[model samples]
Target chain A: MEMLMNPSQMTKKYFTPGVMLVSLIALNGLIFLALRLIFGVGAITNLDNQHPWGIWIGIDVAAGVALAAGGFTTAALGHIMHREEYEVVIRPALLTALLGYTFVALSVAIDLGRWYSIWHPLIFWNGNSVLFEVGICVMIYVSVLYIEFLPIVTKKFIGNVRFKGMLAKLNSPVDKLLRMLDRGLDKTMFIFIIAGVVLSCLHQSSLGTLMVIAGPKMHPLWQTPILPLLFLISAICVGFPMVIMESLIASRSFKLKPEMHVLSKLGSYIGPMLGIYLAFKVIDILIREAFVYLMVLSTESVMFSIEIIFGIILPMRLFFSKVVRESPLGIFIASMLVILGVVLNRLNNFIVAYNPPYATTSYFPSIGEISVTLGFVCIEVLMYRLIVKYFPIISIPEKAGVFKTKYSIQGSK
Target chain B: MATQGRRDFLKSLSAIGISTIGVAGITPSITKASPENILSKDRMGVLVDTTVCIGCRKCEWACKNAHDMPSGSIDDYENESVFDNKRRPDYSALTVVNKYQNDKTGSPINVKVQCMHCDQPACVSACIVGAFSKKENGSVVWDESKCIGCRYCMVACPFQIPSFDYHKALEPEIRKCDFCFDRTAEGKLPACIEICPVEAITYGRREDLVQVAQEKIKNYPERYNNHILGETEVGGTSWMYMAGVDFKNLDFPTLGDKSAPGVSESIQHGIFSYFVPPVALYALLGGVMWISKNRDKKEEN
Candidate 1:
């Protein structure tokens, strides 16, 4: 609700010795991205007619969108569900969602053969297409997330309106604009928040619809008519866990006290949602008589088993334990499992179980494809670091003053 | 020619009727018929008699020549070395003839592979920009002008027919058999259909082809298999095949009778049907907002 640290108290250091590794990886990714753009997708990727979509769609778009579910999920929990305690994590979750969606859009752009025509979806209306719904919803939802994020940006610069040199003359107008924007955003914030949540559900489910069209091509274990529902539920189930995971990771990175009290309570919600997802998943498979396929020790069955066992069921079982719920390490592990589970589920749906009937050989992402994906993620992390440092995205704890000055030197969380 | 062009245009106008008939919105599996039949009652189709195919790759050559691609020489295609490995139709080639050894017949059964051009093509439904259309003449064609080259059509096509010009950096096109749409509109047979020496492939109305296929199968039951490939597969395809052996042996996908778009469209349209679910979802969010607002107000008081 308030700025965690004063602008003056914020760390001035932009780079550290440890940042070299991230820079190198990000550089490598950017290079591949350039190669892909110049030489075309065929030069950088193994994708063929048989395997048209690779990791760019599977991990970067589908999984990326699902993992970013924390934004809308936390918004609903903190504001709509009336959970005041989750307010601390809400800013970070929202920030994560904003950056995550941006990356998803960028990844989609690079993946498209005609990247310039990315704007075609905006002008062209193909309502019957599942992807059309996803494209429209994501475009609108990303804009909503940015609008919801505006207050934080305004909070940082609203008061400190002084600009140096030539810009000094226009500072007052800018400041006035910021104040007016802040006030306007305050009254209308609820609408955008509500829209973000609604739009999220639509597009999150529509990602699943993208795969449903590959009905016969997709393996039975992953292909179901209720794929959209499964995708929506899995995304919802992963939301709180993603928030918890992000909070813990950030705390550890910044050497701040883990908000175990707020997070442990968040932990309580995970099991029930996971249980509901599992129930529907099991029921859907059973109804379709697809469970028989799972019994086979084939690649598809093994991946499905790992996804359900290690990803969903394990986390669900772990979260129910009192020790797991109370401890930060326990909760973190459980959250990671849930996150990985959702990631695997998406990968399985879009890639692993997708066996095109006519394909002579299986598809694997080329080095360039993998690099571009990694680069997008690294860029997301770097951007997150930059934004959180500059903007008051993380709420300052009431007792944070004791450890504040020392942690500021350790740099952005 | 102008009247023929107008008739063709009018036929296409009718064929462009997008089918909205799908199963009720709730039951997950809402099946929608492909917009194939909307254009015309007399959609033209091709019927292939696989048993009679000579495994000569002349169809491939003719297809290239008709499309203005370099066919080299007709003699070059006669080299059987190309069929040494099972080759798929690719960027340069629109159609391919594959020779599969039929164990029962003790001879090779040649199958010509091209776009099946479904009555309800999966590509038509999958194209986000509506680049692909199932014409009244039973040709599933894609408009390059409208194509964004997302390659979803490649993924969605059941026959795996649509090939991308991946090598082209600036101008990539989805290359597939368009059922010789331009030639067909000009009242000319497709080059491949005109060039087949043994009459292995027959060009006619789809309904008439089905009847012809049935008559051939009934007359020479020993020579033909009762199963007609693409007759009912994926809600039927414009390109029908009558093979002497199992279609699977010839690289035909074992698809169910249900059309590819049926299951997907059903789920998508059903969920967003009449915009009811999304409106209801928005209402629920609004309700949540109201309750939350009221609780915060009470706390403040």
Candidate 2:
């Protein structure tokens, strides 16, 4: 038996024009964020009584959560399925989910009118509220994501702990702490992995349930009792594709060979997963008699069509082809479609479907709102780049023994 | 007096005993906030007679005064020019009277708009932090300290009554008609009901108010629409309306008889019901993981 692969930090130039551009966008967002904090949500948002949520909830929290399903999906595949081939991609996926959820939480805090009172949901119980369920689940899941990510921290710094001057005295203690923590986590990691998958399922579905209470305020097309089911299925469908998309991008960005073998295999799984999602969607439409809505060609109908046709169906069809699954560009485009489709679905659910009675004007996100969302995204990219460059997230064959001691290193796969 | 006092004390003791038993009986719904037996029979409500309203907007003035939002003199509300555009309750005003044309007579109909204060308030059921509560007196009052200002209440509300103070970056409250809970608690009418010049708004026990609304419509079929706006809308609101025109013409949403939170709460309970589904899911995943890992190991061996 031989070690198939190992995870190692990428050695690359830390800064580039692209990084600078992302930092600028993040800074632009920070400016608006300061204005939002100093002035109010009203100052930078188009949200009013009729539209209490806008792009922040749609794109940042809901879409962000759905896209981050990669973490749990990859973890389940690698560790639970014992598919060692997927082990190389797991750390990157884990890092992405960790940062993805962190931003979801950060955006939620920013979007709250009383951001300071964000901790209120912890102590005050509201069992009837879907939002309450969502809040609690997301909070716990975020913590779980961090715990799932703790191994990376320990792996990166265990034997490598170093410091300057008088602080060097703390190095041995820190190293001892890391080693103990790593050992404890190694035994307990399975529990967190299972918990992570379960938590993701709970909150991803609960996000759709958040809008079910809106009742008649939501357009009939998107409003259904099976909303939570749809959300969960869609989240699951998007998981592997997100992994494929990110892995390809990371490979390209880091100038390393894409692990097409594992990804192509993952790609093969996407077709059937997507088919399940599309079947549920079509069955839902048929059961609800929602196809009549398609005939009208309104914005809702059009958006729904785009979501199904381009987002789910087309990508799904593309994935079935052995060529598409095997090609980098084809899989990337297919993955991008699924990602965009999920984003559109969330936006439609949160924004487009809502139609408050007596709304004098329809709501749109202000420039400030758009800027802030873009800023958070840029910051996320910058953080991801910084993390992989410095930490053992991307897989390489050298330095395998730093974390896992039993790699034998005898033969090749 | 001593003997009478003794009898009174026993009555009080029995009352406490009965209430505790009742509370124990319905504790689950209370904790879950569907509150089956908790809506008091004597819960106060308002019956708004839109046909009788003159659009004087005096109630609006009184509401602002009572809420201690900024206010103008009573004379300022008399301007008919404001009715050219429709109005809704916003941060500046807790209630507003909007005028609509009567198709039958071509005369203007004045409709007073505010919180319906439903028997089962969507706001109370939707608040992420349990900030909003449906009081025994039928007012859906929110505690400021508990509110994280998530604004899900605005989305949940059937009438879209909740408004926010978006201008204030700090402590932006979800402002709406509180049914004048403070005033009603002091054995006084809601400020708007008290100041309604035409007596268009009548405040009484919800049970009595429904009866009165029914009688009014029955006696003057020509004057009122056959339907009572809030009697069955979103599971009966504390503030019901008897409009001459269909409520839809007055910008009232046509909602079903089911409480707004019914489907949502059912789903929430289904998913988290005593944590059965989640536990089962965990066990199922654990099983799959075990089988898969064992299969992999057996293959290698």
> Which stretches of model 1 miss by more than 4 angstroms?
A1-12, A400-413, B1-37
- Deviation of model 2 at B44, angstroms: 1.1
Q: What lDDT does the true structure give each of the candidates? A: 0.82, 0.84
Residue-level lDDT tens digits of model 2 in B101-199? 888888899988888888888998899988888888988888999999889999999889999999899999998888888988898888988888789
Q: Which candidate wins on lDDT? A: 2
**For candidate 2, what is the DockQ?**
0.35
Lowest-scoring 10 consecutive residues by lDDT in candidate 2 chain A? A404-413
Error (Å) of candidate 1 at residue A147 is: 0.8
For A347-380, candidate 1 gives per-residue lDDT tens digits of: 9999998998878889988999888888888888
TM-score of each: 0.91, 0.93
The TM-score of candidate 2 is 0.93
